[model samples]
Target: MARDYAARCPVYPVRNAWLVAVAVLLAAQEIGAPKVQVAEELEAYPTESVELSCQFNDGGGLTKLTQVSWIWEPSDGHRDNIAVYHPVYGQSFPNVAFKDRVVFLHNSLENPSIRISNLRMSDAGRYTCEYATYPTGNEQGTTTLIMLSKPKNSANGVTVQAGTKSVVVARCEAADAKPAATIEWLAPVGGNHSTSTTSGPDGTVTVRSEYRLVPTPADNGREVICRVNQKTQKQPWVYPIKLSVEYLPSVSIEGYDHNWYVGRSDATLVCLANANPEPTTITWTAASGPLPETVVVEGNKLTVRKVDDAVNTTFICEVKNRLGSSRHQITTVVIEALEDPSSAGVVAGAVIGSLLALLLVVALIAVLLTRSRRQQRRGYPSSGDSIATGSGGSNGGDYGNKARLLFSNSGNNSSKNGTGTNNNGPIYTYREGCDATGTLTEKANDYHHHHLHHASTGNAPTAHDILLSSEMDEAERRKFDLDDSMEEEEERYDRFGGVAGGGNILPPAYHVHRGHAGEEMDVYLDDDMESQRDGSVISRTAIYV
Candidate 1:
């Protein structure tokens, strides 16, 4: 059956040979032959050592160990001896390709494992461990060796000017890996990517990837990352690169505050430019006329020594780079003055004056309030007919204290009638002794003697003496009151003209009574003065103590 299948399919000749060898090995095992044990697969890196293990299992006592040998079978169907072990001659490497690089760990045929040093990519293939038994037959096992290599990674970005078309922005490569490496790109921009693979003569693979995007000025300096992954690396390798996009110079002017006025100094304007290559030339010019003589020109800056009307015009700033040139303009206005220096002072002075006026008003109000309180305490009625009452002595005799009453009318009709029943206007009242609460008291009798002396001289009390009595002594007060009363009485008498004016008038009513004390008399009087329409009058009445 094997021969028939081999004849039908000529492409499977190597498979037929493997099947025949397997059948022979199985037949030998059934007849109690030795079994050879070897690993099915192995892996190694360049410049490292590798071990190929082979062990003989003599399960059947009928077989005796003779020799053990290791062989290399490449993918091209060529076979060669790697190392051999014999009980009589020890170990020996017969293949010139593995001469000094291969050695057996044991000289005995029971266990023969060979160690190969300084491994190369070409050494990766199938290794066969064969055992020669004395009585049964030869048995063998094969192990496949695989070689791995770490790849070299690199990445770079291409410098480009802004454009509308999509183009390559960055490239990443992983070169010379045992197995082909996979590459991916990471970027902040939206774009597309492509990957390609290449193979070298030494069985190493290389992978490359490219990122493409529409170039723009805003995309410049953006980071693009390349990630490479391979079998030999524990983790993926990363490389970051920045994209470079060039463009023309963009120009702008700054530092104009509109407050540029006459006599202003240190006013300046700066020209700012953005470009890939640095700007080489910066210029300042006047758009309407020649620059003012007070203007100072520096690189990218224009300073005014002193602002004037001549500086009120359009100014232009031109910037130039390798790409092109750009210009920006600014219009300036020169005013006669920035602000009035005294205006702040005027406002502050007004505020201070208002505050002072407020304080003065408060002080005046306080003074008026104090005067009103004093008047109230002195028993001066705020509104009523002017009324004066005398006090009696301690022993019910004459108190000997007197008061003078005066009335003045400025209009034809007095504000109040003599009966004290009219309410047309305010009136006045006075009492000799009063308490702090505005209640009249009888304490005036105690000082009646002091007052009587001034009254005996035919003097009358004045409004000033009554109002300011707290500030004067009793005698001083009496003297002022008496002098003021006599003058006022004379003025009133002349103004009234009671009999000289030829008008019928009634005499004042008087009542006199004897006192309990020796030669003491108590007297009471009521006086009234009235005039016709369109007349003015003044009246005074004196009371002796």
Candidate 2:
């Protein structure tokens, strides 16, 4: 295989010539491309200093660094050479707008960064770092400089008269801001707001807002806030103000209690008014006639020295402001006595209490009467004779014994009927005796062996039954007299067939009395007899024959 290859070596030399040509083309492309480094964007506040950085890359030393320049390009597409730096010629500021404000930092073409002092809003523009190289020509990079200005905010309310049509009540503004500010309004009441913007020559904008409403008296002193939002501020600036709306004076009178009475003092009436401008004049008058001498007028108050008949009239209070005047009236009536509102309740309560007390008393009396009747029904025991015998005088015992013996003799003398019907009236003795005070005093321990029966037939009550009846009213019982008892006794004798002329019954007028005992006695019929002190009738003669 190591034989002579002279013909193949000639083809290899032709391929090597093409490879060498491609290498030279790539080497020239890399040498001609150079780079200038700068930030894409930058920010600074007004009147503050900022550095625009720029650096040139000569593509691995294939191209040479010549001179570097800083150019200002505004948004309007206008360019100016502001600063330039060269290794031999040093640094130069060509633009008069940046002559004293901009300077080259390093005085070398590799790093041509510039420091801009006393920055203004107008200085906000795109800055270009341009490099002039030998074979690569011009290489550039741009950086935008943003200048921020925080807005000064203010708000105020306008004074307006109350009207039907809508008017501006408040205004807010944010002035001298680089970026336009957005405005908004906050009001509790019903209203509308509008906004506008203005631009300044130095790239600052002014924002304004107005709040409008149909002004009314109620809208006065209402708080409204204006909020401004700008790019330069972290939080929105708020301004608060109050609206002022004026109207006519609304007047009224106060402090009348309707309890003004004669001889009463410390009464007063005050004139109250609502107006934007305070009321200037307050007047008091009387509709019936001139004001009373008891009334003392000072400012808006009318004080009464003393209430009297002359104060019983209509009173008027008038007030006037800058806008208009208003008045109020009250009718007063001086009464002879103070009208106490709680007096009616007190009277009603007293009446109720009295009625309750009366009911309690009635219940107590009923209980006492019931207990007394129960004792009587049980045959109440006593220490003396079973029959109720009274001792009106020293001979009272002898009189009672003789009367009982007479009654026994009469019962035995009565004859039997033809049918042997036992026709004899029952003799009844008093179960209780009364005193002069109309109260029963004597009580019987036992009902003596005296027969008692009803006068008429058919279940009618007897005299003894009527006397013991609890249903009888106390007042009616007090009206009972000895004459009535005698009449009842005579009826009973007749019913039982007692012959009055045959001496079977005692005479109705028969009486026993002890005048020396000082006992007052009577038997009543047609008001001829007077009442007895012991409520008993006695025969004046003690002879039973």
Candidate 3:
């Protein structure tokens, strides 16, 4: 059956050779072999010393121990003798490759283990402990020495790839590790992945991991990390992959479709988009208003050129690229007017300034008015009303403390006389505070006693007394004029007996006369013969003129 299969299957020859070699080694080690076991297998570094342990387990029957030998077999070549130990001849290393570098652990009884110094990469291979006895023949056990190597990374980390929804290409490799290196994807994204391993002639390994992903916009610019783990290294080796995905534009507006006042200086809108191959053209179009005559559509900025009552309209901004195009729309509100911010400040400042000035003026006027009132109140008693008595005699002294004065019609200042003298004026109305006329007034009851005394004596009048009355107030002067008018109607003065008119003459006495209408007229007795008398005619007896 084997011969028939070898003829049919061309790969059978190669597989049979590998099987035969392994079978022969197994057969040799099983039959008549001493119980020899290698306890430890160790790693080696150049210029370092290491010991490979071989222990005798259930030692097979042997009358005399012959020899113990250590053999070195490289991974790519045949076996070699590292050293041999004998009870009498001692230990000796015959292999030129491990000449001075190897020694037996025991001196007598043929040591089964050997120590090696100044280890080199060439010394990395299988090591065997061989026992030689008279009857048991040769028996051996083996251990392998592994050479250590640091891992290396491959593939560019910044390679950009255009990926689709179904399949995205990403690759990472870790090379030059002793055994096969374990490769894994740290961040497993999108979909599944596959891996492969290859080996070098020196037992160095390379592991390559490939990823097939279904990428989306969210995955654009993502980093895919590949990690390689090896037994010789303390930590896993890692590499990053930057992925870029190409897709349609994702569109938005930054500043668009907002209310803009009519008087605003600038009204602006913005359009934003993320796309592959970038955007080549940017444009703005108006729906209801006049579009800008010449607008440079270079960027995402959209300037609403004509913002007025006429521009209450909608606007559209378009961003275009090689892959696709995107558009955004915005509407404007037609506000009739907007307050100028700068001008508002100015108007407010002016209003405040004007109000301050008005308040200052009002305050100053109030201050001046208050001062005038105080001065008027201070000057009231002495200057507003005054009294001067020309007569310094009993009449003046009597009138000094009087509250009220009433002059009778029969007195020298009475209405019996047509010409009233001494400025005994009419009564005047009194008002509070000072008047604009600046008139002066005084009570005249102080002169009543003197007047009575003078009348009893029948004194006509003194020039000094009449002169003293001349210095009267406005109220006195007005009263005198009123009395004089009434007296003129009631009395006619006789030039023969009454006081004289003109030249400031004083009144002598009071007299009454009858007129044509049978009215009595008060007349002054003429002292200078200045009055017309009835004796010119024959009095009332004569009657006719």
Candidate 4:
């Protein structure tokens, strides 16, 4: 009977307070009035269940409940029946699907509550509950139900390239919510970014944020986050966007500014650069001069085998990547010729000094050679003038005054050579010079090997040698100027013939040859005295008688 009344009875929505008061008055019926109430509002998320209850006089004595009816009135539609309930004849549902999920919490006749399961966005509206009493007529109340839903896969990662005049846009959505969500975008580098939001018919909001980034090397790996905040969610949904940037190479030459000499050393130039997706190739070129003979290029390194042509050249090292190319220059100079005045002065001075030293050495060698030849001809020792005195001839080492030598018998010319005693004496010949220099050693060497008897037994042979008497002016007794080439010749007169005239000052003797008996000429000792070998210092004095 209750199921039939619910299926045939007409129900009106409790739209306003006036309709609610009328239903309360009808249910009272002059008996003790019962309080009829339902939940003021219902809040639920998507895919959840909700219960609408109406408790009339819960003390259980004022009114007895017969059946319960439910109503749903959309804002744009008319009132409609949801279901009805009875206690004794078993409950019935308008739709068979509602019967399995709807359970009543009817502990007493005053409480008749119905539960709705698997609610959707379309179920979000005001619901009305009407309770019929036994002694009273009927009472009705209302409840507002709201369902919250969010879009799936709404927070997706976005890839964006960061560049000048470049923009990256991403959208984040939160759907089927009671109220629209607040939208915001947070960038990694900059502060807050601007965002745009749109609402759907179901009160959901989508936030789309556009970021215009002026990228430098500093902003390569940054992230831009897009966020949407809803009242139902614990935390805001955040979508991060990737920022990729491509840039040109910043290049520099590894080896720079060098000074080198020609044909001395080689130079190597390397290109150093920093770029994304490391550089592919690096080439080296020169402003002037041909390429080196042996040129080897290895990645960033370029080696020039010989720097023979590197005369004030600017070598450019170019580095290339996918983005762009950049180059750096290294200036070099090879000194083919130097015209520095100070440096040239120093070199010239060194060369001149060397030449002077060489000339001095050659002059010394010539002097040495001439001295050597003179020594060989005169038989001299190098250290000044020296003498060996003892045995002469083959026994030159003996240091003595006189020693006899075994010469040929033909050397005996006693009549022409010596004084009255010892007619046969060792003969000697020596040449002497007056020079004070070391060449005077020739005179000393002449006396070394010759065996000459000294005049120790009697007065020595009186001899006088006048040098260059013709160059002296006899009238004025002054020396006449003579040329440097003119050498003084010695005029020696000796009175020591082999005649047996034993007088201190013998008269100048003359020997009359058999063919020229009438024309007689003076005769002297056969040879002049050699250099004294007895280490004696000889002194001469002239006495004019």
Candidate 5:
């Protein structure tokens, strides 16, 4: 085996060795690699600062921690170093422009992150984070930077009267930022300034600026303004302001009172006038009357200490300013004293007494008329009986026999015996008398047979006997009959029949008779009568006297 140690050359073998080298290269490319990616592509509000971080994964075992750096390459092609960190030597270096403003935020072998602060418009550019190992050489991650600008407010303009203060406000807003902004105010020359800040719902910030100023007379034609500031950029933003002022006079006055009563001791009135420039003077005049010497006038008020009985009086107050004059007036009235209560009361009482007397007279007349009517009604007499004298002349008499018989029958049984006048003015007399006839007929039927008798004179008749014959059957007779002889004598003259004599005459000589033999009588008459044949009859037979 030692003797054959000679070399053998073959082309296929060389070709196979070339293929193996190519395969090794492909495997290295697939197994270990450096990759770059960005977490956030965009940002806002540079005042809050920003960070760009680079990370490595699955690094082929060549981790010797060679190099890591951050750079800014502007759109204009200018490049500047930001930060460089090396594990072996700690922090290698940092750019002078960003020495204290940039930060390296990593301590491990995996991360290379950088932070920049106090950003300005010039710093906005493309930034790259690069990392390298001993064998892998280098890998980089990139991001774009944009500097935020502060929000600006619109111009504001306002005008105010001279010596008067006015307020003006302006607002500006910016949103979705890392940090909030501030607000400020700017006023015109010789004006005032103020400011305030607030946050919004979407992480935005708002600035409110306010301005106030008391304009001078010279500033009447000028202007003033308000402005807002959001400090997102380097330069402070500005807003314009315009202001105007006006001037005029003001007048005020006071007097004793709006409503004044007459007879005041002394009235004082005053007038006051003020303006940007004080007024010159004030004067007062009477609008319609010669002002009383008692009137006192002051700066703005006038007083009349004593007032006389003036029917019409007026006071005018006038004030003068540099530009013009103004005047006002008040009027008053006076009258005589009021009447006393005593006199007024006397007049009123007299009126009431006169009315009462008139009413009394009217009532008296009505009563007299009513009484006269009643008396006339009662003066008429009822027809019943009359009487005739021996001379054969008729006379008016009282109630006739029929009426007397009814009274006589009722009186016989009545417990009370008296003389009384009926509503018709007829006098009735009642007394006890005998009804001797033992008649079997009803009382109503027996009334027809009974004869009533009235006195020929005023004297009532005495009791008399009523006899019937024993031969007659007393029980069978309907009523007792008066002896025909006695009745015949009583009716001797036809003058007493009907109402000829007794029925219509008042009784002076004749009176009512009752209780004579069971009879009673009522007397009624209208006037004295001599005979019943001579009186006038209107509706019925009249008694004549």
Candidate 6:
């Protein structure tokens, strides 16, 4: 009975224990394991290195032993086993490229972390970290490494002179690059140019650019720049330098006046010039002809003394510097001479003489005209003279002849009386010549026959002849003298004599004459000869007292 009980209990009880173990294994598969997430990635320069690290959760297991492994996968899908560690296998690396350059700092069974050095372009790839455990199954962490290229080395230098023509050369170089950089000159590009490129000792390429041009005055204060270009950049870099240069001088001249007159005492002019270096020589020369003896030049001043009338005289001022020489010219002219006072005086005298001659001719013409008018008013021929006479008789015949004689000689004494006259009495003797004495006598008988016919019948003898004889006295002759009178009396008689005298009878009588030797005879009479005249005979003489 005991043997039969042990066989039955053994198969049945052991089968039940195997079924419980399978159930526990199935529960462990349902819970998920903790994992490390790689949220960011990095890349580094060619000369630098990178490290990747991660943290994990053990899922409450008492045993700390676990498996960790590192693997690398290239972009071409090739996998490389890098590092691994377990409690039994210890730390191990599979590839030679990761021998010393790759390192794991933490124990892979407890933690998963890594470091890498001496990175190269070939080491660029994606990496993975995996963990193995009993309770919490498999987990993974990922990392990516990328290599970066370095910038190329390019530089240049330049030099220039101020204010002159110049050339500038810029050289640029770069080494060990997949693609080379381009070189350029950043200044104005239109002038002359030359370029050369040569390889350096280190297998790097170097380029040189040269530019040549004539500089201006504005270039003195300006700058020249060089620029370099690379493929990775949008803008180029610049380097700058200043320029300087040297040159020649300029000249100008100014004078006191435009034209210098002849016989001027002095003439002067001034000159000026500009140059970097002062001029060594300054000279003044006559441009047209030889200079006068009085011409003088002192420094920049030109002077001419005692200038003469020599057409146009030209002068030049020349200035010489180290670089070059320059000159300026001036011209002068002279005037004619003036006249003297003697010539002016002669002209004035001629004019005055002509005016005086004209005045004299006009006055002579006026005098001739006045004399012609006077002749016309007097009823006389302008070119000749004439005389008229009348006769007087007794019965108006001899009496008319006597009156005519009286009128003709009114201005003279001859016709008034020639001898003594009687008035109805015996004849009287009239003295013919009383030359020795101033007395005259008259006889009665000489006059009786001349007057007897008119004496009777109450008719007396006319006393006209007696009164005319009385006018022959010395006192009346003295009163008639007109030579001593002013010229105004003579002019009145000559101009108006006919108009002043009317026709009238004058008295007539006898007269006695006397004379001195070598002298003209004179006439005289006594008043007693007219006393016996009768009243019937009329006396026609009108006496002016």
Put down candidate 3 lDDT per residue, 112-224, tens digits, no spaces: 66788987656788888887866757768888887776667775433333454456357777787666688877665656679888987767778887876767767777777
The parts of candidate 2 lying over 4 Å away from their true place are 1-34, 338-368, 381-545
lDDT of 6 by residue, 144-226 (tens): 76544433545444333324455553334434332234555556534444555565332234455555556543444344565
What lDDT score is found at residue 436 in candidate 4? 12
Residues 1-545 of candidate 5 have per-residue lDDT tens digits of 44444434334788899999999998887664446554546464545787787776644555555777788887678888778877777774456877888877886557877777776555767888777765656777788876554554455555445545554422333333324555455444554555555654433455554566556665544544333334555555555454544345455556545434455455556666655445677777787666667667665666777566542477676767655666666665644435543588899899999999999999999998787545333332223324322212233332222111112222222212122111111222211122311111122122213322222222222212111322224432222244654333323312233334334333232233232243433232322222322342221112110
Candidate number with greatest lDDT:
1
Q: What residue runs in model 1 are displaced by over 4 Å at the alpha carbon?
A: 1-34, 61-68, 85-96, 132-137, 338-545
lDDT of 2 by residue, 1-545 (tens): 33456555445777888999999988987666448888999999988999999887665678787888888998799999998887888888889988799877776788888899999998999999988888858889999999888898999999998999999999999999978889988889889998888999889999888999999999988999999999989899888899999888888888989888787887998988898877889889999888999899999899999999999999998888888888889998888874555587998899999999999999999998897545433323212212122332211221221121111111222222111112122222222123311111111111221223322332223334434645434643443334755434322222111132322222243132322353433322111222223232222111110
What is the lDDT for 442 in model 6? 33
- Clashing residue pairs in candidate 2 are 426-451, 511-538, 511-539, 511-540, 512-538, 512-539, 512-540
User: Is 5 or 6 the stronger prediction by TM-score?
Assistant: 5
lDDT order of candidates, best first? 1, 2, 3, 4, 6, 5
Model 3: lDDT of residue 387: 27
lDDT of each: 0.68, 0.66, 0.56, 0.52, 0.49, 0.51
| 477-505 per-residue lDDT for model 4 (tens digits) | 21222332211211011111121232222
- Please give the distance, in angstroms, between residue 97's alpha carbon in candidate 2 and its true position after superposition: 3.1
| For model 1, the run of ten residues with the poorest summed lDDT | 421-430
Cα lDDT of candidate 4 equals 0.52
Q: Please provide, for model 1 over 130-204, each residue's C-alpha lDDT reduced to its tens digit, 9 standing for 90 to 100.
A: 988877678899999998878989999988888899999999999989988999888889988999999876678
Better of 2 and 3 by TM-score: 2
- Which predicted model would earn the best TM-score? 2
Q: Model 6 Cα RMSD, Å?
A: 27.7
5 or 6: which has the higher lDDT? 6
